[model samples]
Target: MYRVSLFPTRDLHLSDLRVALINYICAKQTGKHLIVRVEDGDKAHNIDGKDQELLDIIALFGISYSHLYYQSDNFKYHLQFASTLLDRKKAFICFCPDEKATPYDGRCEHLSPDEVLNNPNPFVIRMKTEPISDSFVIMARNKYPTYTFACAFDDMLQGVSTIIQDEAYLENSSKEELIRHAIGYDQAISYTHLPTVHESEKSVQWLLDQGYMPEAIANYLLLLSTPTPTEIFTLEEALSWFDIATISKDSVHFDMEKLGFINREHIKKLSDMELSKRIGYACENIGKLAKLYTKEVSTTLEIKQKIDVIFAKKEPLATFEAESKLLQELIFNAPYFEMFDEFQAYLLEKSNLHDEAFFKPLHFWLSGSVQGLELALMYPLIKNYLKEIVR
Candidate 1:
């Protein structure tokens, strides 16, 4: 069985990342079981939906974790450990609130468990931290007093040997080491701290100034770790590259426009018929793709008008306006032709450019949106119908 743990502190985002890691790791190392534990020991700092939504999101990724553990579920264990340290004069029970706490309040450290027990109003168990010495180094603005006694024991009991975390947590190693000693787990577990991925600092500052979509944020994060950065691949190639180890640590900037461009590129690579089918499917879901130039349901009749005559030898227009001012202008301005007959004869004379020119109007007129099936594919259906009609 593989034991994994996360201190799902205040944000679900971190929890989701934890789940993603576990899912990825499990796939790479098959025949291994997975266990997930949430660290919610700090009830005071707890956030809503910490349990249910976190579970739901993890499951949504389709990873089947064998066992799930919650820290709060083991509150008695933490309390027991805290109690043992207290009895041994290793930890103190403090009743002080936020505003009045002091380092030397030795009030609780010195007080016997019984004494504090009798005088208790509301008591929070605080582990006795080692005195301020050269040992404690400041990394960020916050001063970290390692919980040597608790963290070590927990990590060892959980059997988590390698930690995949961010570098910002490097300073916590001291406390984790202490806790490791407290629990008597001597086995060495390698720690690989990943770089913090974020949009550029400037982009983050800009987001703070304006606003952004959470989906956009997640999309950016996924792109930061997207498997294929340069290579354009088909569906078959994509399904083969779903490994979690492929994720990168470089922070990606958030750009909805860029996301749209990438998605359009992906959609464009599909063949016309496939593009039409996918558009229909996308339309059913969001109705965004259904509303196109053709008032009708993009049937063969409408598609043919332009897609068909693509290879025709002549421009068959029955009416000037029916061909649209744009197409009319192209034909009228032709240097080789003086009249309609001359234009048709001239176009028919060049078989190579004939089909291409016929497809141009429909390709240009329909599918204003970027990247999809070629418009020419639909021309065969409506070409004959538009034949003398546009004359």
Candidate 2:
């Protein structure tokens, strides 16, 4: 049974979501168990309601966990485990000042427990690390277990066979291992260190506020994890293709352009009715416009704005020599046909001008750009615009 952990400390951010997603995908694909552990061992920094917010965000991404645990709940176990290490002489209480900036130097390693108890100074229990090792000593201060101590103890207690953590926690692996060895736990918990999601620029919430969809963010994150050329895929598709060995060790930078491209692709896949529902308004001609203009838009508001722009009259840049004749022909023939196809045929037959020159100016006048929805889809809107202006 593989057990993965999602450890959110404080307010969840894009980096936290990224870690949760990577672990969730791995555990789901392997048909293993996923555990969500709120690492609130540090009571000083723990914020109320942030834990629920993290859970809500996880649900927003459709990720589920088999078990939910909090490091703070196992305080007794952690303290008892620390006491065991102390009893075995593998750990010592440090009498260093609480405000000291220097690292613990095993100053109290030789002090007896009676001496430690007799001392009036507040002290912290520090694990005696191996000599000539880069691993830092694990500390438990004021009944609060350090990250390394709590994590190792909880993983063993919960039977976590696998630990997926951020690469920033890579250094703590040795400390955890030493704790496990001191505790005489034989089974080794496999560790997968994922690269950090760089948030030095814009944060995830900022992107969401800017109209980026959750689907786009997830797809972009999956692309960053592996070297696969496939850009657009659903979470289920990503799960089937996810392989832990294939994950890149190098840090992944955020790409806003790629996210926009993915969001546009998703927007194109929505049905006209679905688009209108998201747009939060209806127009007599919005259904047709939604299908026609969605390819160029990323958000529902953008679609609505584009539709409004299309309906609103735009002043012509320069009156063409053939403009008077074209407008007269359109006014006379537009009422004869209800469908755009027939109207288009009528315009072709009546106008002596070339198709590109005759239509390009009108297209530019209506949309202020030549590149937009096909004129056939814009026919009704264009006719309405022309009628108001011609009067």
Q: Could you report the Cα RMSD, in angstroms, for every candidate shown?
A: 11.3, 5.6
Question: Per-residue lDDT of 1-391 in model 1, one digit per residue for the tens?
Answer: 4444444444344323533453445434655556676766555566767666556544543445767776656545655665565566555555555412454444545676578759847655554566612122111112122233334555666766656555566667666765555444588866655556443333322321232222233333444555664444432233355454766656434444564444444443445555445333221211222223233322222333333233233443333223444453443344542344454455445423335455444333333222345434333333333333233
**lDDT (C-alpha) at residue 373 in model 1:** 52
Candidate 2 per-residue C-alpha lDDT over 1-391 given as tens digits, one digit per residue, 9 for 90 to 100: 3443444455555666777787888888878888888888777777777778777767877788888888888889988898899888888777766523345455566887689779998777777765522324456447678888888888889888887777888988878988999989999788888888784466555666666667777777778868664778877778877777998788778776777888877766666566666665454445556656657766555666776565555554455636644644465445646677776667666665565666765565445455587776677645655554333
| Angstrom error at residue 72, model 2 | 1.3
Name the lDDT value of residue 7 in candidate 2: 42
Q: In candidate 2, which residue pairs get closer than 3 Å at backbone N, Cα or C atoms, i.e. clash?
A: none
Q: Which whole-number lDDT from 0 to 100 does residue 129 have in model 1?
A: 61
Quote the lDDT for 13 in model 1. Answer: 46
Candidate no. 1 TM-score? 0.51
State the lDDT at 206 in candidate 2. Answer: 63
How does model 2 score by TM-score?
Answer: 0.75
TM-score of each: 0.51, 0.75
What lDDT would each prediction earn against the true structure? Answer: 0.45, 0.70
lDDT, residue 295, model 2: 70
